[model samples]
Target chain A: MGKGILVVLSGPSGAGKGTICKAFLERNKSVRLSISCTTRAPREGEVDGVNYFFTEKEEFEKMIKEDKFLEYANVYGNFYGTPKSYVEETLNSGYDIILEIDTQGALNIKESFSDGVFIFVMPPSLDELKSRIIGRGTETEETLNKRFSSAADEIKLAEKYNYAVLNDTVENAVSKIESIITAEKCKINRIKDHMDVLQEV
Target chain B: MGKGILVVLSGPSGAGKGTICKAFLERNKSVRLSISCTTRAPREGEVDGVNYFFTEKEEFEKMIKEDKFLEYANVYGNFYGTPKSYVEETLNSGYDIILEIDTQGALNIKESFSDGVFIFVMPPSLDELKSRIIGRGTETEETLNKRFSSAADEIKLAEKYNYAVLNDTVENAVSKIESIITAEKCKINRIKDHMDVLQEV
Candidate 1:
């Protein structure tokens, strides 16, 4: 077996990245989502390792200092990060991993893992994005406007990604991501070992 | 519609490139095979425009002189070439085109069309390749050995391709090619117009 692929999925908040990732995971059993380490407390029904490897703030901070995180950020006085060891081990063990992160985190991860497949999920339009965010009903008009502009700014960064998948529908988006993974596996660089074996034959 | 992709499929003669291309086209109705211009007489059941675009030797030489062919070669006193204009027009019209050619022709096409998706197909094993060639029952023992060595030489060039797919089965090869086409469509560089439209939104 070959070393598995690392797919970094990123986009704006309301671009249906989460939904697409979930649907993709459901369809692709061989791929596993990278479990993030967080300082935030686990909510109801959330398993310790399955949902997140919840840790204390002190440990999370120590991890940051050790450069153990692929990318980390302090959100609402709580820490969230992707543990580099976990992802590396999974990939080395021949298990594809998907990291669904925001634009900033994805870019940060790129610096350390340039080989990862960076995919940017996109909303169909700004109006569609606004409607989706508004559907959450958890933001005031002021906050909504701020998030809208931030999302627009994020969309501009999609150019930095290797592929931009428009989230017109969860099914379509998931299918496209699946295709990306399939194509990546077929890439010449990725199948060097296979080629070598064939050469020997 | 977005511009169509030019997929250049190449491999050794016994690597099942032709079978995979035919299977892929059967499933993918939108993609058309690029018709080659040849000076050879059309065999029984060969259509002028479908199987090949038969032309006079002088006409083919004129096209070669005008640099109208993407790639051309003379074999056994017969000339064959890919028409550059037809490929460009098909892509401009947003219909994907597949070019099934040998390794030399594919590399030649690459010089002029670097944006094309170049895929190198491989048999499961060289022994399998030998058996496949033998199955054809056309070559003598001396010619078989020569062809086998030539195939080995060609396999070495697979590294130059963007993707290398093992033709373990026709279905698997066709599916992988389809995935490649789907993934190529999602490439960031190819979707510049889509990005521009989304930016305005």
Candidate 2:
């Protein structure tokens, strides 16, 4: 079996990246969602190793010192990180892993895993992005303005991604992502081993 | 409208490149089949401009001299060439064009159009390729051996292609090609203008 693709899915907050990722996971049974390591307390029903490998702050900091995390960030005060070993094991086992992260985290992952597929989900328009953020019903006017401005800035980073998929609908976005994965598998760089075997034949 | 992709479909003689290209064109309404210009007389049912733009030998040579043909070759005394303008016009109009050519022709086109999506179709195995060639019922034992050896040599050049698709089945191969085209459209390099427009918004 071939090594699995490490897909880093990112976009602005209101671009439906989460919904698209969820739908893509639902459609593709072979792909796994990369579980993160966090120092924050688990929510009511979150399971260790499933939702996250919840750890104490000291242990998380130790892992950071060991360079065990592919990427990590301190949100507010809690630390959340993608464990490098877990991602490496999943890909080595020939199971694709999707990491839905912010643009900053995605760029950090790029440094460690240059072969990873970076995809940026795009909102149909700025106005639509505003409506989606407002539809969440939790953002204060000030926070909403701040988020909208941040999203606009993040959209500028889309050009850095290997591919940018428009989140016009969950189904369409999932299909496009599926196509990207399929095409990446067929890329010549990924098939060198297979080519060697063919040559021997 | 975004620019269309120029898909170069090539493979060994018995790799089913033609079948896959035909199936892809049948399924994708937006893609056009690139017609070749040839000095050979048209077959009984073949239509001009549809099957080929049949031209006199002098005209074909003049085109070669003028550098109007993207790639051309003399095959068994008959000249066949791909018209560069027809491909450019189709792509400029935002319609993808599928060029079903041989490996040499494809590599030649690459020198001129490096951005073209180069896809090499592969038969399941060398044995299967030989069987397929024999199945065509046109080769004698001697000619079969020659064709089979040539196919083996051609397979080695597949590494030069951007993608190598196994023609285990025509349906599957066409679907993979479809995915490749879809994914190529999402490539960041192809969407620079779209990105500029989004940034402006």
Candidate 3:
């Protein structure tokens, strides 16, 4: 059998990527979601390794120097990166890994792994996006404006990704994500590799 | 919402393309199978305009001259071609169309309608392909051998397809074909067109 695929998914804040990711995991057994490692202090009710593999800043920087991360970024004085070991372990175990990272992190990961399948999720419409953000009711008007402005910039980066999905409905979006993983598995290169093994056998 | 996608599938004899197409249509409700028109005489129990649109050779040649067929060719002294009108009518009615055509016909269709998704199905192995060809039990040993020889040449052409699915198992193969269609719908160009329309609104 051939190795599993590395699938990277990204979208703007209000695009419902998280919901679709959860739905996809519930339906598909072959996918493994990649949990990120963070150098930030854990907050209340957050586990050390569940929400994130929390690490000290010194340890994070040391690993960075040692080339242990697939991609790392500093946000608001907190360092976050995808651990290389976990990904390799899951992929080697024959489970395809799903990395629900942001656009910048997706780009960084792509820089390291050229063959990774990158997918971008989009909101059905700008007005629908605003409605979703407002529906959250956690942010102030000013903060909501910031999110909307950031969405425009993020959608532009979507053009750089390998595939783009429209989040028109939760079911539709998750179905597309699942299908992408299936299609990536059926790629000629990967299938050829399987045939090579059969030939040898 | 935009229209559904059109997929053109082709593979060598005994490659299990027919089985995959059948399973895919059973699973996906929006897909419509395209029946090709041919000048060849229908075999026993074959229904007119169902298995194929059997027509006179002169009529087929006339349609070719009129550019009515999207792709047409002469095979075994009989003309076969996809009619453009029926495909367009079904597509305009908001259904995806699957064309189970030969590699040459697929390439010809791709030339004019570049947006159609093309997939090639291959057998798990060369030995398995021979077994499948013989398993049909309809073809004589001599004819099966001829087809097996041609399968080697067809496998080479499989590289030209956008996606190559190995018909290792009917269920798994169907899942991949369904995935290809689902993933193609999530393409940025299609979503971007929707977003553009919304922006105007």
Considering DockQ, which of the candidate structures 2 and 3 is the better prediction for this target?
2
lDDT of 2 by residue, A1-201 (tens): 789999999998889987888888889888899988888787667799877899999999999999999999986467989989989999999899999887888988998899999999989888889899999776679878878878778888988899999888899989999999999999988986865436654
Docking class of 2: medium
Candidate 2, B1-201: lDDT as tens digits: 787899999988888887888888889987899998989877667799887899999999999999999999875468989999989999999999999988888998998899999999988888888878888786568867877778878888888999999898999999999999999998988986855437665
Better of 1 and 2 by TM-score: 1
DockQ of each: 0.61, 0.58, 0.45
The weakest ten consecutive residues by lDDT in model 1 chain A span A192-201
Q: What ranking emerges by DockQ with the best candidate at the front? A: 1, 2, 3
| Candidate 3 residue runs with Cα over 4 Å from true position | A124-145, A168-171, A196-201, B26-29, B135-142, B195-201
Cα lDDT of model 1 by residue, A14-92, tens digit: 8888789888999998898998898987866778888789999998899889999889987546788999898999999
Q: Count backbone clashes in candidate 3.
A: 0
Return the TM-score for each candidate structure. 0.93, 0.92, 0.86
lDDT of 3 by residue, B1-201 (tens): 677677988888888887788788888876888999998778667799777899998888889899899999876467899999988888778689998887778888988988788898877788888888888787767777778778788777766777888788999888788888778776666565655523533
Clashing pairs in 2: none
lDDT (10s digit) by residue, model 3, range A122-196: 777777777888987867688788787887777787767888877878888888888887787776767665665
The better candidate by DockQ, 1 or 3, is 1
Interface RMSD of 2: 2.1
Q: State chain A's TM-score for model 1.
A: 0.89
For DockQ, the strongest prediction is 1
